[model samples]
Target chain A: MRHTISVLVENKFGVLSRISGLFSGRGYNIESLSVGETIDPAVSIMTIVTTGEDLVIEQITKQLNKLIDVIKVVDFLEIDHVEREMILVKVAPRKEDKPEVLQLAEIFRGRIVDSGQTTYTIEITGEEKKISAFIDLIKPFGIKEFVRTGKVALAREGTRKGK
Target chain B: MKISGAEILVECLKKEGVKHIFGYPGGVVLNIFDVLYDEKDLQLILTRHEQGAIHAADGYARASGKVGVAIVTSGPGATNTVTGIATASMDSIPLVVFSGQVPTLLIGNDAFQEADIVGITRPCTKHNYLVKDIKDLAQTVREAFYIASTGRPGPVLIDLPKDVTAGMSDFVWPQEVKIRSYNPTYHGNKYMINQAAQMIAHSKKPVIMAGGGVILSGASKELRELAEFAKIPVTMTLMGLGGFPGTHKLSMGMLGMHGTYYANTAVQNSDLLMGIGVRFDDRVTGKTEAFASHAKIMQIDIDPTSIKKNVRVDLPVVGDVKNVLRDLLKTLKEIKEQQWGAVRSAWLKQVERWKEERPLTYRFDKNIIKPEFVVEKIYEVTKGEAIICTEVGQNQMWSAQFFKYDHPRRFLSSGGLGTMGYGFPAAIGAQLACPDKIVIDIAGDGSIQMNIQELATAVINKLPVKVAILNNGYLGMVRQWQELFFKERYSHTHLESGNPDFVKVAEAYGAVGLRATKPEEVEPVLKEALKVKNRPVFMDFVVDWKEKVFPMVPAGAAIDQMIFDEEKEEKKLKAVK
Candidate 1:
C-alpha cells in the first residue's frame, strides 16, 4: 500500500541523509519524496510517499521519530486529511480543436497558462484523482509535456495532531 | 571556519576519526591531495593502482567496522575503482570512495580525464553525490560518511568536480542531516521478540544459519548465546565463516555449494532454520524451490528486503542482528546444559562419521605439488589463528573447505562479488588493522595477476603479509569444468607459457619470493614465509593442474544431487583400486 507520511523535522544539515540512509539501508521503496521548510523557519516538513506493509510503515515511523531532529511523523492515510495535487500540462492542440479544448478546460476549472500556434499550456489543481481524471480526459488531445507534484497533504480541520 | 572544499574534505575525515586514507594523485584530485599533504593528523598510503587503493579501503572497512575511505582521479582513475566499489557494495562493506571530476564548465564537453562518475557509480553505491558547489562539500562529505556507515553499510561515492574542489567556501560540517526518505530501524519490537522466543522454544530440531551480518553487527557472542540457549546447531555461509567457532560441536562448518556434507544434511533435515544475518544466497541454497522445504524458517536480517529475497520465512524479524539477538536472549529460557550436551554430542558424532567417510584429503606425490596439501599445511601451521583472505577460483574453494576459521571477521574474502584480485589487498588491509596477528592471502596464479601490483604496497609498508599462491599453470577452475563437461577442449584456460616469473617479480617489489615445485616443499616454504617479520613474502607453489574441488553440485542442481570425488571418471579407477 502507498502511504504519505508528513514528518516535521528540525532544519539541520545531514538530517536529509540520515532519513534517506535509513530507507536505502533497509531497502525500502520511496516512490516520491519532497522536503522544504514550512512557515516556521526552524522546522522543515517532508512529505514522503512509500509502499510497504503495516509493520514496515509502523517501523519506519518509529525509527523516524527516534531521529534527534525529527519532531513528528504523521501517516496521512490513518488521519482525516485534505490532499491536493497540482499539474502543469502542455498539449499540442489543432487550431480547430482549441475551442473544444478550452471548453473542456473550463468545465474542469483549469486555467490556460500559455498558448502557441499549435500548443496550449494548461494548469490544474485538485485532489489526486481529479487531476488524474483531467489528464486522462485531455490525453486524446496529445500531451506535449506534463509535470505533477505528487500529492501534498495536510490534516483536516479540528484534528491538530502533534508528535 | 573559512575553508576550501579540499580542507572541508579533510575536516570531515577528522570528524569521522579517520587516521589513514589510501589514494593516488591525478590532475583533478591534486588540490585534495595537496590539502591532505599539509594535514599532519591524517596519514595517507599511496597505492600504484586506484583499484588497489579502493580494495585496501574495503579491507580496512571489513577489518575495523569503520567506513574505509579512498580517493582517486577522474575518468580512468574513477573507472578503476568501479570493481572495488562493486565488490564492496556486493559484500555490504562500509566505504566512502572519492573521485575527482572535470570542472563544472568542462563537464559536458568531455574534458581531459572526464567521466560521469556519479552516473557510473549510482548502481554500485548505496548513495552518491556530484558536488557542484563548494559550499555543499562539507555537508556532502558528512552525509557520505553518515550514509556509508549506517544500517546495512555499503560504499558511497562522492564525485567532486575540479572547480568544486578548488572553490573556497565557509565550511561548517553539519551535525545532523534531515533526509526523511532514509531511516533504518535498529531495534526490534517487543511483541516480535516474544514471538521469536516462542518459535525457538517450540522448535525441536532448530538450526541457526548465520551470515556476514553477525560480524557487521558485532553479534557473534549473542549468536553463540542464542544457539546454546536453544540447543540449535549452527551452519554459516562463506561470508559467515568464523562467525561461529568451527571447533564448537554445534558449529556445522560451512553450508551450501562446497559446504561440508554434515552441514548440508543438517540444514536439509532440520525442523526449523533460524537464519540470522544471512541473505540465503544461491551458493548456500542450491535449488531454491527445494531448499529447506520441510523446515520452518525464521529470518532475522538488518535489511528488510533480504527477508523474502530468497527462501520464504514464517517469522521475519527485521532489525540489527545484535539487537534482535540481545532481545531474544533476554526473553528466552536457557536450555538445560545436559540436554544441550546430548544433542551436540549426537550432531558431532554424525559430523565425525561423515568426516571419516569423506575426509578432505588429497594424495601428494614426490614429484608434483598439490594445492590441497598446501592449504592443509597452512591450516596446520597457523592452527586456524590467522585470517585467510582468498582470491577467486580453485584456491578460494580449497581454502574455504580446508581452513578452519573459528572466529568472525577472520575469513575475509570477496564472497558476493568473487573479485579475482581481492585477496592481496584485503590481506594488506586486514594486516594493517590487526598488525600483531597473522594475515595470509591464498591466491591462484590467474587471480594474483589481476592485482599483483599491490606487492609494492605490501613491501613498502612492510606489512608482513604471507601470500600463498597456488600455481596450477592454467585457469584451474574453468579448465576443471571444461575437462568434466566440455570434452577437455580447453579454449583460453592456459597460462603456462606467457607469465612473469612471480619469484623475480616479488623480489623486484622488495619482497621475499619462495617457489615450491615439489609437494614436500610446501610446508617449509609456508613456514619460511610466515617468519618474514617486516617484509612481505610470496610463496608460489606449482600444484597439479587436473585437480578439481569435489563434492560438486553443478549450477542449478539440487543439494542432494551432488557429484562426489569417487564419481569422477579419473577418480573412479582409484576408488576401485
Candidate 2:
C-alpha cells in the first residue's frame, strides 16, 4: 500500500538530505517527494509517497517523527485529504493528431504552457490518477519530454477523527 | 561579551559541566586545541587515534551517565570516528562529537583536508550540525548536547569549520534549548499502564526481559521490584547484563543466541512476557515469528519505533522505562498482597529444572587454560566489583557468560554494533571516569590489536586499566562458524602465524604485561596484574584454540532449538555439521 505522508519541518538547510538519508538508510524508497515553504517562512511542508506494509508504514512514520528537525508527520492514509501533482508534458504531434491532442488536454483542463513549431508543452495539475490518465491519452501524440512535481497533499478540515 | 567561536565552545563545555574531553588533535582542529592550552577547568586527553577517542568518550558516557565528548579534525580524523559513532548510536549511548571541518568557503570546493562530515555522518547520527557562522556556535553546542542526551539517547556530531572557530561573535549562551518537534514522553499512557498491570497480576507464567534501556534509564531497581513482586523470572540481553542481579535465583541469565539454555527455554514456554526497554534484536529473538510464540508480550521503550520493530506485541507502552515501570508498579500496588508464590510455583520449578539440567559450563583442562576459566578467575579475584569492558568475538561472549554484572553500567561492551577494537580504550575511559574504581577489558587476541596503540594513552594518564587477552590463536568466533557450518575449512581465520606478542607490546608502551600459558598460572597472572594500581596491565592468557561458545542457535532457527556443547548434545552438533 502507498501512503502519502505530509511532514512539517523547520525550514533549515540540510533538512531535505536528513529526511532523504533517513529513507534510504531504512531501506524505504520514496515513490515521490515534494517540498515547499508553508505559510510560516520558518517552516516547510514535505509530501512524500512511499510504499510499505502497515507495520512498516507505522515504523516509517515513527522514525520520521524521531528526527529533531521534523515538526509534524501526518499520514494521509486515513484522513480525508486532497492531493495534486503537476506535470509539464512536451509533445510532438503530427498535423492530423494535433486536434485530438488539444481536445484531450482540454478535457483534462490542462493549459498549453508553451508552444513550439514542432511541439506543445501542456501543464496539468490533478490527482495522481488523473495525471496518469492525461499522460496516457497524450502518449499517442509522441511525448518529447516531461517533468513532474511529485504529489503534495493537504488533509481536509473536520475529516480527522475526533475533530 | 564578545569572544571567538573557539572560546565560546570552551565556555559552553564548561557550562555543560564537562570535566574531560577524549580527543585527537589534527590540522583543522588546531584553533580549538590552542584555545584549550590555557583553559583551566576542562582537561583534554589526546588519544592515539580518533576511533579510540570516540570509544573512550562512549565508555565514559556509559560509566558516568553524562554525555561523552570527543573532538577530532576533518578528513581522516573525522572519518576515523565513524565506527565509534556507529557503535554509540546502535547502543543508544549519549555522545557529542565535535569534528573540525575546513573553512565554510571551502566546504564544497573539495579543498585540502576538507570532508563533508555532516553529510557523511547523517545516517548514523541522531542529529548533526555544520556551524557556518560564529553566532550559532554556542547554541549549536548546547543543542547538540541536549539532543544527544535526551529521549532515546544517541550520538550527535557538530562539524566545526575552521573559519567559524576563528570568527568572532557575542558569547551569549541559550539558557535552555527546546525543539518544538522533539518533546519526549517520559510518562507512559495511563490506559496502557493499567492494561499492563492487569496482565502482570493475572499472569502465572511471566518472564521479564530486560535490555540496555533498563541500564540507561537506571530502572534496574524498579525492574527487580516488579519481578520479585510478581514472582517473574528475569532474562537479560547482552547489553542488559547488569540491569538485574545475575546471581539472583529468579535471574535466568542471558537469552537468545549464546544465551543460557534455561533462559531461552523459559522465554519459549512463557505465558506472559514483559519486555522492558528491549528492542528484540534478531540475536535475541532468533526467528521472530517463533520467539515467545506461546506468550503474550508487552514491550516498553522510550523510542516508539523500537516497539513492534522486529516482533509484534500484545501491548506496547512508549515511554521511558523508569517512568513506565514506576507507574506499572504503582498500579499493581492496588492489588491486595501482590504475591505470586503459589500461582507461579509450578512455572518457576520448571525453569529451575531447565537451569539444573543444562547450566552454562565449559570443560576444565589441567594442562591448558580455558577462556571461561580465565573469566571465572578474573571474577573471583575482582570479587565482581570491577567495571568490565570487552572487545568483540569469543572473549566477549565468554566474559558475558562467566563474569556476573551485579549493577547497572558495570558491563560496557559494543553490544549493538559489536565493534572489535572497542574495549581497551573504553576501559581507559571507564577508569578515568571513576578513578577510585577498577576497570578491565576482556579482549580477544584479534580484537586487542585493533586499538593496541591506546596503551600509550593509558600509560601516560596512569589509568590502572586491566586488559585480559584471551589468545586463542584464531578469530575464535568466526573459526567456530567455519568449523560448524562451513565444513571446518579454517581459511583465513587463523592468526597464529602473524600474531604479535601482546605482553611485549604492553611493555613497549610502559605498561605491565603478563602471559599465562598454562591453566595453573591464570590466577597468579590476574593477581599480579591487579597489584599495579598506577599503570595499565595486560594479561595474555593462551587458551584452548577450539573451544566455542555453546547453547548456540543457528541463524534463522527458533530460540528453543539450540545446539549445546559436545558433552551435552554431541549428536545435535554432528547433525548440524
Candidate 3:
C-alpha cells in the first residue's frame, strides 16, 4: 500500500544519503521523496511516499528512529493528511485547437506559463488525482515535454503528529 | 586557544574515560596518528587487520560492560569493519568505531582513498555520522558515545574527514543530551507489571527465559532474586549463557536449537512463560506457531520493536529488563503469595523427570578424541574459572553446552553474526580487559586459520590467551547439515587439504604449541596450555571427522521436536539412571 511518511531530522551533512541508502539497501520501495528546511533552519522535514506491508513499514520506521539525526517519523495513514503534487506539460497547439486547449486549462485552473507558435507550456498544482485528471484531458493534444515534483504531504493539525 | 579536530577527538575520548583503543593506522588517518605521538594517557593496540580491530573492541565491550572503541582508516579499512559492526549489532554490544575519510572537498570527487562509509554502514549501525565541518566533531562524538552505550546498546560510527581533522575549531563540550524523540522508557508500565506479577503468583507451571539483556543491563542480581523468590526454573539463550548462574539448581542451561532437552520440554509445557530481554529469533522459537503452545508468554524489553515482532506476546511490557524485573518483584510483594503446594511440586517433579530422561551425554573412545570430551576437559582444567570465547559452528555449540558459565560477562562469542575468525582477536581484547583472568578461545581448525595472523599481537603484547582448536577435518556444522538433510553429499565442505599444522604455526609466532590425538591426551594438553603464563599456547586436537552435534532441531522444526542419535539416545537414558 502506498503511504506518505514525514521524517524530521537534524540539518547535518550526509543524512539524506543515509536515509536513502537505508531504503535502497533494505529493498524497501520508494515511490517519491521531497525534503526541505523546516520552521527551524537547524532541522529539515522530509516527506516520503513508499509502499509496503505492516512488517516492512514497522521495520522502516523503527530503523529510521535508530538513526541519530532523525528526530521523528510519522505515517500519514494513521491520521488525517493533505497531499500535493505539481506538474508542467508542454502541449502542441494547432491553429484551430488552441481555443479548446485554453478553455481546458481555464477549467482546471491551470496557468499557461510559456508559449510558442506550436506549443503551450501549462503548469498545474493539486492533489495527485487532480493532476492526473488534468494530464488525461491534455495528453490527446500531443505533449511535447513533461515534468513533475513528486508527492509531498502534510498531516492535518491536532493529529498524531503536531507539537 | 584554538584546537584542531584531531586534538578535539583525542581530548573528547579522554573525557569519556576511554583507556584503550584497538585499530590500525592508514593513509587518511595518518594525521590523527601523528597527534597521538605525544599522548601518554591512552594506549593504542595495533591489530593486524581492520576486522580484527573491531572484533577486539567488541570483546572488550562484552568482557568489561563498557563501550568499546576502535579507529581505522578509509576505503578498505572502513569496509573491513562491516562484519564486526554487524556482529556487535546482532548481539547488542556497545561499540564506537571511528573511520578516517577523505577530505571534505574530495569526498564525492573520487579522490584518493575515498568511500561513502556512512552510506555503506547505514543498515548495520545503530547510528552513523559524516562530519563535513570541524565544528560539529565534538558534539557528534559525545552523541555517538551516548547512543552506543544507552538503551539496547549497539554500535555507532563516526566518519572523520581528513580536512576536518587538519582544520582548526574551538571545541565546546556538549553538556546534557536531551533528544526529544530518542528517550527510552526505563520503568515498565505499572499496569503491565501488576498483570505479570499476578500471573506469576498464580502460575502452576512457570519458567523464566533470560537473555543477553540481563547482562547488558547489569540486572543479573534482580533476575536471580526473582527466580529464587518465586522458585522458578531459568533457561538462557546462547547470548545469555552467563546471565544466570549455570551451576544453580534452578538453572536449566542453554535453550533453543542445541538447548538441553529438559529446558525445551519444560518451556513447551509451561503455563506462564516470562521472556526477559529475548527477541525470540527464529533459531530460538523454531516453529513459531508451536512454540510455547501451552503457555501465555510475557515479554519485557527496552526495544518496543522487538516485542511481538516474531512471537505473539500476551503481556508486553516496554522497559529495561533490570527496571522491569525490579518493578515486578516489588509488585509481586504487594500480592500475597499463593499456596501452589502440590500443584507446583508436581510440575517441578515432571521437569526433573525430563532432565533425567535425556541428559547431555557423549561417550569418548579410548582410541580417538571427541570434541565434546575436549570441551569438558577444558572446563575441568579451568575449574570453570576461565573466560571462554568461541569461533562459530560446532566448536561454539560444544563450548556453550559443556563449559558452564556461572557469572555474567564470562562467556563471549560471535552469537548473532556468527563471524568466523572472531575468537582469537576477541580473546586478546578480553585478556586486556581482565588481565587477571585466564582467557581461552575454543576454535575449529577452519575458523582458527581465518585470523591466525593475530598470534604476533598476542606474543608481542604478552597476552596469555589460549586456543583450543577442535580439528574435525571439515566445516563441521555445514557438513553435519549436509549429512542429515542433503543425502550426505559432502560437496565442498572438506577443509583437510587446506588445514595447517596449527601446533607449528603457534610455535612460529613465538608461542607454545601442543597437540592431542588420543582421548587420554586432552587433559594434559589443556593443562599445559593453561599454565603458559607469559605467552599464548595453541592446542590442536584431532577428533573423529564424522562426529556431529546431537539433540539437533532442523530449521523450521518445533522446539520440542529434537532429533537425537537413536542408539546413543536410548543408551544414554539408561546409563543416566
Candidate 4:
C-alpha cells in the first residue's frame, strides 16, 4: 500500500539528506519526497510518498521519529486527510490541434503557466488520479517536457486525535 | 572568556565529565591534540590505528556506562572508524567520536584530507553533526554527548573542520540540552504495563529473552527480580551475556545460532516469551514463524522501532527496560493470587531435563588442546572476576559458552557487527575503565593479529590486559561452515603459512609473551600471564583447529533443529558443566 507521510522537522542543514539517507539505507522505497519551510521558520514540513506493507510502514514512521531532527510523522492512511500533487506539462501541438488541447485543459481545470511559439506549458494541481487523467488527455499532443512536485498532505483538523 | 574552538571543545569535555579519550592524532586533529598537550585533567591515550581508537572508546563506554570519546583526523582516519561506529550502533553502545575535517572552505572542494564524514556516517550514527561555525562547537559537543548517552544509546559523530577548531569564539557550557525533536519516553504506558503484568501472571512456561538493552539501561537488577519473582527462566542473547547472573540456576546461557540447546527448546516450547530489551535479532529468531511459535510474545524496549521489527509481538511496552520491569513487578505484586506456581515449576523442570540431555559440550582431548578448554581455564583462573572481551568467530563463541558473566558489562564483544579486531583494543579500553579489575581478551590467532600493534599502547600505559590467543591456525568458524555445508573444501580459511609467532610479536612490543602448545600447558601459560602486572601479556594456546561450535542452527533453520557435534552428542555432558 502507498502511504503519504508528513514529517515536521527542525529546519536545519542536512535534514533532508538525513531523511533521504534513512530511506535508502533501510531499503525502503521512496516514490517521491518534497520539503518546504513551515509557518515557523525554524521548522520544515516534508511530504514523502512511499509504498510498503503495514509492518514496513510502521517501522518507517517509527524510524523517522527516532531521528533527532524529526519532530512528528503523520501517515495520512490512518485518518481523514487531504493530499495534492502539482505537475507542469509542456505540450507541442499542431496548429489545428491547439483548440482541442485548450478545451481538454479547460475541462480538467488546468491553466497555461507558460507558452512558446509551438508549445503550451499547462499547470495542473489535484489528487493523483486527476493529474494522471489530465496528463493522459494532453499526451495526444506531444509532451515536450514534464515535471511534478510530488505529493503534499495534511490531516483533517478535527480528525487528528493524538500525537 | 574568548577561546579557540579547540579550547571550547576541551571545556565541553571537562563539563561532560569525560576523563579519558581514546584517540590517534593526525593532520587536522593536531589543534585538539595541542590543547591536550598541556591539559592536566583529561588524559589522551594514543592508539596506533583509528579503528583501534574507536573500538577502545566503545569498550570504555560499555564497561563504564558513560559516553566513550574518540578523536581522529578526516579522510582515511575518519573512514577507519566506520566499522567501530557501526559495531557500537548495532549493539546500542553509547559513544561520541570526534573526527577532524579539512577547513570549512575545503570541505566540498576536495582539498587535502577532506571527507564528508557526517554524510558517510549518517546511516550508522544515531545522530551526527558537522560544525560549520565556531559558535556551534560547544553546543554541538554537548548535544553529541546527550544524544549518544540517552534512550537507545548509540554512537554519534561530530565532524569538526580545521578552520572551525582554529576559529575563535566565547565558550559557554550548556547546562542542559533540549532538542525539541528528541524526547525519550521514560515510563511505559500504564495500561500496557498492566496487560504485560497480567500476561506474566498467567504464563505457564515463561522465558525472558534479554539482550544488550538490559545492560545499556542498567536494568540487570530489575530483570533478575522480575525473573525470580515470576519464576521465569531467562535466556540471554550474545550481547546480554552478563545482564543476568550467568551462574544462576535459572540462567540459560547465551541463546542464538550457537545458543545452548535448552534455551532454544524452552523458547520453542514456551507458553509465554517476554523479550526484555531484545530486538529479536535474526540469529536469535531463526525462521521467525517457528521461533517461540507456541508463545505469546511480549517485548519491552526503549526504542519503539525495535518492538515489532522482526517477529510478531502480542504485547509491547515501550519504555526504559528498568522502568518497565519495575512497573511490571509492581503490577504483578498487586494480583491476589499467582496461579502459575505448579505450572511454572513443571516448565522449569522440563527445561532442566532438556539442559541435562543436550548440554554445551566439546570433546576433551588429553593431548591436543581444545580452544574451549582455554576459555574454561581463563574462567577458572580469573575466578569469573575479569572483564572478558573477545574477537569474532569461534574464539568468541567458546568464550561466551564457557565463561560465566555474573554482572552486566563484564563480557564485551562485537555481537552485532562481529568485527574481528575489536577485542584487543576493547580490552585496553576496558582495562583503563576498570583499572583495578583484570581485563582479558580471548582472541583467535586470525583476529589478534588485526590490532596486534596495540601491544605498544598497552605496554606504554602499563595496562596488564591479558590476550589469550586460541591459535587454531584457521578462521575456525568459516572453516567449520565450509566443512559442514561446502563439502570440506577449506578454500581460504587456513592461516598456518602466514601466521606470525604471537609470543615473539608481544616481546618485540615490550610485553610479556607466553605460549602453550599442548593441553597440559594451557593452564600454566594462562597462570603466568595473569601474574604480569605492568604490561599486557599475549598467551598463545595452540588448539585443535577442527573443533566447531555446536549445537549449531544452520541459517534459515528453526532454532530447535540443531546439528550437534557428532563426537559429543551422545557423550555425558560433563565437560563444561
Per-prediction DockQ comes to 0.10, 0.87, 0.44, 0.93
Which prediction has more favorable DockQ, 1 or 4? 4
In Å, residue B164's CA in model 3 sits off its true spot by 2.7
Question: All models: lDDT?
Answer: 0.84, 0.93, 0.89, 0.92
lDDT score of residue B150 within candidate 2: 88
Cα lDDT tens digits, model 2, B149-169, are 989999999999999988888
DockQ leaderboard ranking: 4, 2, 3, 1
Task: Report the CA-based lDDT of candidate 2 relative to the real structure.
Answer: 0.93
Q: Output the number of the DockQ-best candidate.
A: 4
Error at B142, model 1, angstroms: 3.5
Q: Estimate each model's TM-score.
A: 0.83, 0.98, 0.94, 0.98
| Poorest lDDT segment (10 consecutive residues) of candidate 3 chain B | B336-345
lDDT score for residue B315 of model 3: 96
Chain A (candidate 2) TM-score to true chain A: 0.97
Error of 3 at A37 (Å): 1.4
- Which whole-number lDDT from 0 to 100 does residue B495 have in model 3? 98
Clashing pairs in 3: none
lDDT per residue for candidate 4 within B1-577, as digits (tens), equals 6899889999899999999999988899899999999999999999999999999999999889999999999999999999999999998989999999999888799988888889999988999999999998888999999999998999999999999988898988888889989999989999999999888877888999999989999999999998888889999999999999999999999888999999999999998999989999999999998899999999999999998999999999999999999989999999867755575889889989998987888888998998899999899988999999999999999999999999999999999999999999999999999999999999999999888889989999999999999998999999999999999999999998999988899999999989998889988888888888999999989999888988799999999998998766444356656
Model 3: per-residue lDDT, tens digit, A32-78?
88899998999998888999987778778877776667899988878
RMSD of 4: 2.0
Q: Rank by lDDT, descending?
A: 2, 4, 3, 1
- Higher TM-score: candidate 1 or 2? 2
